[model samples]
Target: MHLLIAWCGFVGAWLLFAGPIYQAATELEEEGFERDAFSAQIDTVEVPERPSPWWWLLPPVGYVLQRRRQTEYRRRIMAVMTQDQLERMVAFANTATGWLFVAGGAFFIALKETWELAEVYELSVLLFVLAVVVMFALCALHTIVRLRGTHQMLARSGTARNRDSMTDEPPATSDA
Candidate 1:
């Protein structure tokens, strides 16, 4: 009973705040990255591929390992990737956040039930399913709110990159 209440509270807080928390953290991390990136020699720029769907199947352990890989990949990419590429990857990860929550919650419940750490297995599963639904809804809505700004930034950087290559002289206007 007490465990269930605690779990519910955690889920509620996550639904209400996780998206903004993720966005803020990523934004802050980007600041330092931008600084170091300017000085670094760029021999190669390797864009990261999205992970395969097999991740969720491994349940609890897979999530941790996948996250570690994600961090490593992000760090590596930030060292050389363009602003548009970095932000686009971040946005894609943001969109996938809800599944991480769902996998984590469900895996916890499964582990607890297997070890007899908690009772009421059926109810726990049901609650977690509902929580997953709520998480998906909240994250989707948050993504919608944030997508435009991220996309605009990407567009700006892309245009800037293209403009940087052009000759300084302005394009001649056609005579009317």
Candidate 2:
């Protein structure tokens, strides 16, 4: 099911954003440059393919999956964490979970578009610039969210670990 969603995302992105841009780039290159001059060039400028429209669907699908996973994760945490800690863990994971789908969609979409324009210099350059800006923005935002989630996880983990260590601590006997 996940694979199907991913494939749909890949194909949709190719069809929608990457394909048209690539077609445009190819046609543009053919206009002025000689077939061999443009053809033989190892690399070309191009925009990153637009992310898959199907990728838009990923959010809901991923949400369902995360909710399912959350149940299991909570079960595991039950033994070690306080109720508050468990709540924090679920909330933290939930917050950044959406980005996974977003990134996946963007990656697949961008890859499809970029891969086709591998040789069109001007087109490739334009695509690359656009892709870099967009990708960087996506990545920077995702990273910040993930870091926050991680910090929350670490806090809970530390609390759990301390509880364990305390359990292991021997009683201090009074010296008579």
Candidate 3:
């Protein structure tokens, strides 16, 4: 019963986090389609046709079709998004993933303590470590990429400033 409750809670939390993101992405995709942003590339895309209902009898075939559809939809959405928008979406996703990991770790830790299970304790520790690693890795990657772009921008601006100053008239000297 406790395990079932925990599983339900996990699903609820996932829905809470994922629902808004999914809605936003869907809206964005619809807007993109309305603007004909995907029209030009539509021909180039290998969109999988909707599978027949009979195919659902074969679970593997159904799963593959579903995956293909999702992949194609994601591709279209990504193609429509600008770089800044994509980066923001990615950052949001990373934050959500980090939080989920932290929550999962906490859940496992609680479960271990409540049940006094050695295996659960080990699993809790593993989840905690995974949470830390994932959070750290995502943060590091974001910082590195952002810093690289900033450094390049600053370098270019500095070079331009130096060039402009060099081309300008020299300051006049004051005679005593």
Candidate 4:
């Protein structure tokens, strides 16, 4: 009875925490598409093809493959981005990673305390697994947010450049 109650509580809390992260990640992904659109507008930029959804049937392999594609895409973006923009992304990645580590550490410590007090090995292991899943999800979301921000910056810079160039040229006066 107690175990069931604990499980329910844990699940409820996980849902509450993960819901917003998932929503934010989805929004960021949509925003990231703008970067691809911007690239498409350029004549020489080559966008990489996305991996097939069928790859997801093989979990470990699929994850690695997806990550490789994402890294390659990010590298392409970074290639044209300014040093200041790159630095901002690096700093954000560092800070988000640090916070995740701290949060994971605190969660583990609390889990340990709970295990010692309750001696519920089954529940402890379950909690540990869930925590790992949550941590990884958070990390993925953070990466998405960071990349989205970079994409936004790049898109804005491109727009500003286009605007400047448009304004710089003298208007053509056609002689009737």
What would the per-residue lDDT of candidate 1 be over residues 1-176, giving only the tens digit for each residue? Answer: 86776566555555445545445445544544444444352435454565666877878767876787788765875766777757765665665575466545654544443333224343566665665566556655676666667778999999998888674677889999
* Residue 61's lDDT in candidate 4: 84
Model 1's alpha-carbon lDDT is 0.58
**Alpha carbon lDDT of residue 78, candidate 1?**
77
Whole-model Cα lDDT of every candidate shown, in order: 0.58, 0.53, 0.58, 0.61
The alpha-carbon root-mean-square deviation between model 1 and the true structure, to one decimal in Å, is 13.1
Query: What is the per-residue lDDT of model 4 for residues 74-133, given as tens digits with 9 covering 90 to 100?
Result: 778778766766675566556556555654555554454444434444446676666656
Which pairs of residues collide in model 1? none
TM-score of each: 0.28, 0.29, 0.39, 0.38
lDDT of 1 at 62: 70
Which residue ranges in model 4 land beyond 4 Å of their true spot?
1-47, 54-64, 119-176
Scored by lDDT, the top model is: 4
- What would the per-residue lDDT of candidate 3 be over residues 2-58, giving only the tens digit for each residue? 566655554454444344444444344343333354355455565667778787899
Residue 32 lDDT, candidate 4, scale 0-100:
35
Q: Could you arrange the candidates by TM-score from highest to lowest? A: 3, 4, 2, 1
Instruction: At residue 39, give the lDDT of candidate 1.
Output: 37
lDDT of 2 by residue, 1-176 (tens): 65555556545654454333333333333333333432333234232334445644789876666666666654543554556655654554454454444545655666754544433333566766675466455545554565567669989999999999988968889999
lDDT of 4 at 49: 86
Error of 2 at 122 (Å): 12
